[model samples]
Each structure stands twice: as C-alpha cells, then as structure tokens.
Target: MLRSCLSKVISPCQSAFIPGHCITDNILIAYEINHSLKLKSCGQERSMSVKLDMSKAFDKEAERCGSISGFRIGSRGPTLSHLFFADDTLLFGKASLQEAQHIRTILDLYKAASGQEVNFDKSAVVFSKNTDPTVRRSITQLLNIMEVPTHDKYLGLPTVVGRSTSEVFSSVKERIWQKIHGWNEQRLSKAGKEIMIKAIVQAIPTYSMSCFKYPDSLLSDIQSMISNFWWGDGAKRKPIHWVSWDRMCLSTNDGGTGFRQLKAFNLALLAKQAWHIATQPSTFLHRVFKAKYFPTKDFFQDESTSRPSFTWRGLCAVRRYLLSGSKWRVGNGLHIKIWKDRWIPRPSIFKIVSPSDALPEDSTVDCLIDKDSGK
Candidate 1:
C-alpha cells in the first residue's frame, strides 16, 4: 500500500503535473496522521506542534551583516563581513554598536537552533592598533565578548603581522623535534628513517612555508634534524657523514635520495600562490590582494613599501621568479603597457625599451597598431 502511494507521488516527470509536490504533500499527510494516531494511543485529548527552524533566520542575519559596509582594506574596495572555516569564524567590521548588535542577534539565533551556547568567556574581540581603547571596550561590552590583545592561533598556524622570524617559528621546530624524538630510532633502519623524514618531517611546516618565507636559521635547524635522523645520529653523539647533505637533497636519478631542500620548496610553494593571483584573478583571495596591493597597476611592477605586511612581502619576494619566466601574448594589445610589460620575444630585453627610452609615459602596445588599415 505504501509503495503504491509512493509510486503515485514519485512518477516520471512527464507523468505527474508537478512531480515532487505530490511526494511532499503525501509525506506531510503521513506525518500528521502518524502524530494524531500516537496522541490518541496515549489517551491525549490535544497535541501541540513545536517547530524548531532557524536556518532561514541565520541566513537572513548573515545576509544583513554582509549587506552593511564593514572594514575596508583600502580607500576604495569591498568590505569584509566574516570568514568561516567549519566552526572557526572570524568577524571583521568597524568597531560600532550596530555591528556588535547584529553579531549578537546572529549568535542568539544559532544558539536557539543548535542547543549550543556561545561561551563569551572564551571568545574574544580584537581591534586594530589605531582603534581607541574606549571604543574597543564599548563594543566589547555591547557584544558581551572579552577584549583580547592578540590571537595566538587560527586554524593551527600562529597569527602574525610582520616578517615571521626564527623566533616566531620556534614552536613549529619544537613540535617536529618532539615527533622525531618520540620515534624508536634504534629499531628503524636507514631506509625507514628516510621514509619517515619524507612522509612526516617534510609535511610539518608545509602550511607555514606556503604563507611565509621561513628564516634561513629555522630552515637550517629543521634540515639538521632531518639529516641527523637520516644518518642514524643519537640524541647526544654525532654520526659519520658519508654523503653531503646537498647530494641527498638531489633527485634519485642524480645519485641522491630525493630529499627536498626546505628553502627551494618554500619558494616553489609561494610561487604557486603568485601564479594563482596572476591567472585566477576572479578568486576571492586574489580580488582582496588586487584591491589592496596593486589596485591601479600590474602585480609585477608593485613597488615594495616600507610598511608592507609580512604576507604581501612574501608574495612580492617570489613574484620576480614568476615574472622572469612569463611573457605577454598580444591579442588586442589593450591590456599590455608598452615599456612596463614584457610582450616581446627577446629573452634579455623582454620590454620593448627601458622606461627612460619609451616614447610616452603611459603608452600601451595598442599604440603600434593602425586602427583604419588591415595592417
């Protein structure tokens, strides 16, 4: 009987007037009947329906928060509302009562639906250095959130501003050291050690390497640890060095073990980020970077400022590698600047001429083409 009813509701698209509507109607009817029957079986005279729906409410609130202007990255750019990954959420907005109230309302709606409460004691609100302490306190009180000086960790990596020095990555080194120490090196063979180093040790700092330029000293410390393990060195004693560390880092085809060099690997990873920024300009991260750093110019020509953020500096540092290999393929010639861009085939002289020798200050390749003639 159930199958027959279901079949009537769940027919071919052409057979039913509105295919899923019948199924939905049948399910609602079945639910109502089941609930009434249960109530009657319990000898209940009346029953009440309790609906717990907050997804729409939360979505509406998120939309409203996004609609309102928040913290701007530059003089003219898109505002940021929030960035979320799983349950880890970071809200960004101007320090004001209205923003605080909106956040509170969203949290309240979330709590009511999920039966999960927000622990304001643990949660904190952070403000920029330029923000006034009085205003910070006011916003903190309005949202009932604790005001914190700085965030130590976000998504496992440490949150930092300027260049990530050796001290900043000390904890990462210690964690890798601990992992290496915990292993039974005595029982593990040379091959086993190599495998462990490749699989585990190399992956430890990958996320950090992709974001920041690891200090040479930090890289050296990590490499030393990996080398000691590879050559069967104990906690105290030094082992005999058969092969140079450089040889082991080379490809296996070149009489080496194929271990990666940390510095080169870090550069390659960062270069990948630069590649994305160039090719995938439509991505959210690329858009944010373009707006803030290179708003009116090409990314390659972006001059380093005295106060560039650590992340921006790292990206800029690796951008030269990308620019050295890249050449512009002329289409309409509208986007490529004459002297600033590398549109020519010459390896040494990629630009048509030096900035000093170029005809006009702001001429593009389009100037060379004749508009009226086929040539």
Candidate 2:
C-alpha cells in the first residue's frame, strides 16, 4: 500500500500541470489539521510546530537526473526538456504525526492520480530545530530512519553538544593510518607531489593564507631571499657558507629559519582527510560513499594493500611523514621507481637528500637511486 501510494507517473513532456501541486496540497492539509488541533487544545495558544514542503520539486528533476532518469533532452545543454526543472519550495506547519501522515497519504493519492512516483529512497527528514537530542531521537522514531554517520572527523573538531575533545582526536587518530597504508608511489609525479603537498598544507588553518594578518610582504620577502641565495649569479657554481642563511631556513627549534616545510605540511593535511574517511562513516556524504564505493572492505584495512584504494594512494607523500630528518639517502641512480619493487638498474649508490627532495625526483614518480651508483 505504501509503495503504491508513493509511486506516481507523469508525462515527461507535460510542464503545464504544476510540478509539486499534490505534495503542496498534502502539506497544506497537514498544516491546517495541526493548526486546528492546536487551537482546540489551547483555546488561544500558538502552535510551535513547523512543517516545510518542497514546491516545484520536480521542475529540475529531469535536468538534475538527465538521461540517467530514462529520458534525455534532445538539446545540447540546459535547453533540454523534462519535468521538475526548478528549485522552489513551500514551508508550512504541522503539529502532529497524524497530520504529517495525512499529508503523506494525500501525496500518495496525488501520485496515483498522476501515474507518478515520489522516490522515497531519495528523500529524508532533517531536524533543524534547537540543539536537543530529543529532536534527533524523535525524528528517527517518527520517520523510521537510521542516522548515518557524517562528519566523523567533525565529531572531534568542536560541538555544542555531547562529544568530548578526546573522543574527536581519538577518532582522528584511528583513521589516520588507513590513509597512510593507502598511498601509492606508482602514479605520482613531481608536479603532483607539489600539488598534494600544497593541498595538505592548505587544510590546516594555521598554515593557510587565512592565517596571514598584514600584507603578504613577509612571505614574499622570504621567497625572494631564498631565490636569490640559491640561484643568484654569485651562487652559480660559487663557493658558499652553509651558516649564511641557516638561521633563516631551519626550524626555530633547530636554530634555522622558521619557514613552513611545504612537503611535511601537505602530508599532514592529507592525513586529516584519511582521518575523516576512517572515523566519520555516520556523516551522510561518507555514508553514501561507503555504500557506493567501499561497502565490504573495512575502511581501515587489517590486511596489507596489495593495491591501495585510489584515495589512499593519491596522497603518496605519506612515506615522507614516516621518515626521520629532512633528507633521505638515494641508494641508486634517479631511475628507481618507488612504487614498483624492481629497480630498472640496481645502483647501490648513496647521496644526501634534502627535505625539499622528499618528494620523488623531478622527472619521475618513482626514482630509485642505487646507493652504489651515486659515486
């Protein structure tokens, strides 16, 4: 009976009939009933319940859904034809479950009349009232809905309700490694490495451009200094003293310049995203992704990744986070592929690597250096 009530069919070519008239009718009926009940109970008191109904909900339905909906617009773009093409909505009031249910029943009747369907699978009730736990519980009970975990990482950020800071950080940590084990050395590139690093750095508010207070002159000056010192005519094949700019280039703790390490910052930021994926499955977006992309695999895999998921592998700078110091030794020529096991030519070479080069070689993703070949 519910299925039949929810199912309605409308001609795709027909826009003359109002798109959501039936739904609006039901909402209005619910509102009227709720108002009548409140008036009868209070004699003169005001009802607090509010109801909202989507109007013209189906106007954009055809375009948003496109050919995926079993119909296609013959035109090139937005000029296409279909039902429900707009995003207008109606807000009403309903005081009781019975009143809301009455609207639902009427909506079903409308669908039956029009030979259309409501697609309940795509709909849900959201509680926008006060920050009362009772609201969530009540809506869940009334709608027979199960709350999906969304914003699991956000569960740790800040909240006006029940979650504690420890709980948030704990959740963040649990998911962090899931992101680590998923990075791939194979498909990354020098440019991609830079991009990933930048993204990760941008995620943390402290390192972002938003943190800049005055003019960006401070940063611009530092960049200019480095460029001059590293690439100046005097620097070209010229003898240099390491101590000259050591104070400006190193960490404050280490007696060097207090500049941000772009690569390290990027990995840390990407780690945050991994934390979200592993911890916040309840958030709607993650839940949807889990349902569609990773239904069976535990997001935090206990088994080794013979092949890492695309997202996990996308942030390939992760291994750098696990390494100590800024530079790593290259054991061979720059032809090694970090993603694959076998090196093109095993060069047992050794050379000093800087934090800046923690990313792959400039020309390739996996540059395996044979420690023996560097000499």
lDDT for each of the candidates?
0.61, 0.33
Question: Can you tell me which runs of candidate 1 are displaced by over 4 Å?
Answer: 1-60, 65-68, 162-164, 233-235, 304-306, 346-358, 372-375
Reference-based TM-score of each model: 0.77, 0.25
- Clash statistics: count for each candidate: 0, 47
The pairs that clash in candidate 1 are none
lDDT of 1 at 219: 94
* Top-TM-score candidate index: 1
lDDT of 1 by residue, 1-375 (tens): 564575354322111243222222222122222222222323212211111112222233564537333444455545545443333444555556666676677777788777876666656665555555677777778777676655444545545533448887898899889988876456587787888889999999987777677888999999998887777645567766788889999998999999999999999988976676667564445555666678876677765454455566777889888988888988778888887788887788688664765467768788887887723
Global local distance difference test of model 1? 0.61
Best by lDDT: 1
Candidate 2 local lDDT, 1-375, one digit each (tens): 543433245432222243323222222222222222222333221122222223334333323443212211112111212122132222122223543444355456556666665444433333222324554555445544343322111101211112242332333333332332233323444344334333542233332221111123333433343333332333234334445444445776887545454334445655544444445654332333343335554344223433332233523334333322223333543433343222323344222223244554333322433345544
